[model samples]
Every structure is written in C-alpha cells, then in structure tokens.
Target: MIIFRPPKYDAIDHEKNLKESDGLKFATEIYKGQRSLSAIVEFVLSRIKNYVKKLHNFDQINKYIQGRTKTNKSKILLLTDKNKPTPLIKSIAIDYLSSFETAYITIKKNEKDEIFDFFKIDKDIAKLPQIIIIDTKDNPNEKEEIIVYDGDLNKVALSHYLSNFATPLEGPASKRMDLLNKHKNINNSQNNKKDKNKKKKNSKNTANAHDEL
Candidate 1:
C-alpha cells in the first residue's frame, strides 16, 4: 500500500496578538475563484498565459493568491501545456505554487494521459490547460469539490505604487478569525487577572500563558 505524506500546514500562534501572528501577513486573502470545472480550466489557462505576459521574467512572480495560499491547508493542481511556460517558467511556477509547502502537482499536457488514467479523468478534459485545486478533500476526486484561482491581479500596478498597502481585514475568513482570536486573548487575560489580587496581574499571566505558546 502506498501512503502519501500528510500536508504540512502552518500552525497559528493564537497566544500572540494578530499583529505578531502569521495570520496578519500570510493568512489574509479572498478565495476569488470559480468552482465549476469548465470555468476553472479556462480561467487558470488564461491566467497562466497572462501571468507569463504580466511577468516577463523569473525575478518577481508576486501576487496576492501566491501569498495567501501559504498558510492553512491547501491542495492545488497546476495543469498547463508543457509548451506554454518554456520549461523553466513551468518549474518556477511549480516552485511558486509550492509556497509554504502547499500540496500540489503540475500536470503537463503529455503526462495527464497516464496521471488522469489512474484518477479516471476524461481524456479530452485532461487535454485542456488549467489548474485543479482541492481544498477540503484528502483525495483528488473529480466528484469532490474543486476550488480554483489564478491569484488576484487587480491592484498589481496600484499596490506597487502604494507600497503594497491594502486593508487589514483581507476577507471574511480573516476578519472573523482575527476578531475571534482577539476576543479570546482578552477573555483569557481577564480570567487570569481574576486569580490575582490586582488587575495589574496580567504581567505574570503573560509569561505563564506565553510558556507553551
């Protein structure tokens, strides 16, 4: 039996405030994608072409989604024609997709035949150029949900001029998470203070709570 390695997901430091945690920098971004199979295939193929055009060289492959998928559990597949990325770019793209050790596979046009055959994906479907992203499911099944995106290129130029500044709350996911974690810290601090004689007892609790943090 073949046992695939589990995903190496980054753990959030809930003990610290949002400002010092990984969520502030990396876990913030919108899903900005399509769920339909056909739509995603076309979307990714077009974006891959555009990503190469938008980025003429290997120096900077920067994008929002590239930064976003680094945290949390992410399973992504990058399917493209072997000829599209000129081999080197293809490898670079794969490296970029592997940000923060994301689980992914680059299914080239030629290799899809053998790979898809095992997974039982359609031949014609395999021939198309696109990416398949699986978020919640452990196995890559066609019947399962496939969430896909090519990153948000909306403010590529504007963000550059603005020194890469954006909203602190990226999307609903991060907003809710930040709020929840923020409140959790407050509650824990308050509870710890109750065990002491004065309200200023939080200093020691900070160290106590910070122990295994």
Candidate 2:
C-alpha cells in the first residue's frame, strides 16, 4: 500500500523526496515532478520491479497462486489527494489496472474517508514523507497482522518487518554460517594466545628453579 500527497504544479520537492528514498527508480520527470501521469505509472511499475528483485519468494508466491487457478498478481492500493481524475491520474490508474490488481481512492480536501478510519491513520500520518501499511495473513487460523510504516521509505526496515512473515530461502542459513565462522575464529585466536602464555610461564618457572638450584 502506498499513500502520498499529490504534488503541486511544481513538484520539485516531491521529486527530490522520491529521489532521496530511491523511489524514482524509473520515473522520467522532465521538469522535477512535472512529468505526465504516465511517468508516475512507470515509476510505480519500477517500484514493483524493485520489490520483486528484493523479495525472495515473490515469484514462488505467484506460482503458488497460479497453481491454485488464481490470478498471480499483487494487490496494490494507491491513495492520493486528488478530487478529480486528471489526464495523468487517469492514465496512471489505467496502467495500474493493467499491470497489477490495483485499487485507488481519490481523497477530496477535508472529506472524511473511511479508509483512514480502517487504517487508523490521521492527518499526521498523511503529512509524512510516505505511509505504507502492510497486511499479512500467513495461516488460515492466525489473525491478520498489520505493519505500519510512516515517514521516509525505509527499505531495510520494510525488509526486516516482512521477514517476520516470510523469510528469504537462504537468508537464515547464510546468517547462521557467518555467526558460526566468527565465533570459530575468535575461539581459535583465544586458544592460540592462551597456549603461548602457558608456554612462556612454564619456561620462566624452569629458569627460576635452575637459578635457585
């Protein structure tokens, strides 16, 4: 889920914000955020592409869905502060519909929307650099879990949070191996130092005994 405030005619600040977060992956903004809605759609597509690259089981999840005779796609929800659908917004919506199973909501100024209530978000959250709510349901019996992230887009935080739901195939094993190797090296170094100290002490004791004799 992605929620953002609509940029004004001069969207330089927004563009800069996106750039800072690496969110402008494939967006072509001729003049800052002055690009057409098509460009915005392209930017979103790029985000999805980046997501797939980072997510280990994204393809596997799609395959599972396909095997179950279901459409294999992500459910993306885009919320924007736009009262009317401009040409760019409309085109962006169309692109989203075609690419992913997407739903969008246009929020009017000062209009009370139910989505905010559902997400338990307020004006403060909307004012942030970005807001995304991730919902995961890993088991049939387990209650749905929601993770909310506000402020700038943090890929590391997002990855770590999502790992609680589904871990990467090799991530745990590689981490364990690294820890084991570190400990093994530390132990070997300590033992070598201890052996050297023991030999030095024995030699010193023998010298003292010979002198006394």
Candidate 2: pairs in clash = none
Per residue, candidate 1 scores C-alpha lDDT tens digits across 1-213 of 112222222233323443454444332223356668876555544433111222222122222123332233333344454434433233233233322122233454456676556445677744534443444333434233444443442223211221211122222223455688799999999987776645456777778889969
Global lDDT of each candidate: 0.39, 0.41
Candidate 1 weakest ten by summed lDDT: 158-167
How badly does each model clash, as a count of residue pairs?
0, 0
Per-residue lDDT tens digits of candidate 2, residues 35-118? 588766756544332111111222432332233112232333334564332333233233333222323344445533344555
Assess every candidate by TM-score.
0.26, 0.31
lDDT value, residue 93 of candidate 2:
30
Error of 2 at 32 (Å): 21
